[model samples]
Target: MLDGSDLKSVRKNAGISQTDMANKLNCDRRTIINYEQGVCEPKSSQLFRWLDVC
Candidate 1:
């Protein structure tokens, strides 16, 4: 599973902004920020959705 930092890196490398990621994940941009900051972990389903994006 991808860690917070790893997710951030993948998003960056994919040229996806936090807002865009949030849109795709059906969450707020702050949620994406929180994920990157290690404030909380994404749910398994959410993580899977993100992986689908990758």
Candidate 2:
């Protein structure tokens, strides 16, 4: 299972920014921030979409 740090690492490694991730995920920057901050988890569909795009 991907956790907040793991997601952060992947995004940094891939050179993807939070705003860019939000655009790809069809959400807002705050949502991506929430994910990385562990305030919430993405929906399964959102997770898959994030993986697909990033």
Candidate 3:
């Protein structure tokens, strides 16, 4: 699982919207929201893509 702070920072650095990242990761916007809010963790494949996009 990724650290929530890191996730938020990366998203900001990449200038990516939650919805945009969700679209790129083939997930729902709620997924990104959850990750950012630290409500849930992303899966391995999603993590890889988040890193790639970030």
> What's the TM for model 1?
0.90
User: Stretches of candidate 1 above 4 Å error?
Assistant: none
Best-fitting candidate, measured by TM-score? 1
Pairs that collide in candidate 2 are: none
- How does each model score on TM-score? 0.90, 0.88, 0.88
Model 1 residue 27 CA deviation in Å: 0.4
Any runs in candidate 2 off by more than 4 Å, and if so which?
none
Which clashing pairs does model 1 show? none
Q: Which ten residues in a row have the lowest lDDT in candidate 1?
A: 1-10
- In each prediction, how many residue pairs overlap at the backbone (N, C-alpha, C within less than 3 A)? 0, 0, 0
lDDT of each: 0.90, 0.86, 0.88
Instruction: Compose the digit string of candidate 2's lDDT tens values, residues 1-54.
Output: 558877777888889999999988889999999998888999999988877776
Better of 1 and 3 by lDDT: 1
Candidate 1 global CA lDDT score = 0.90
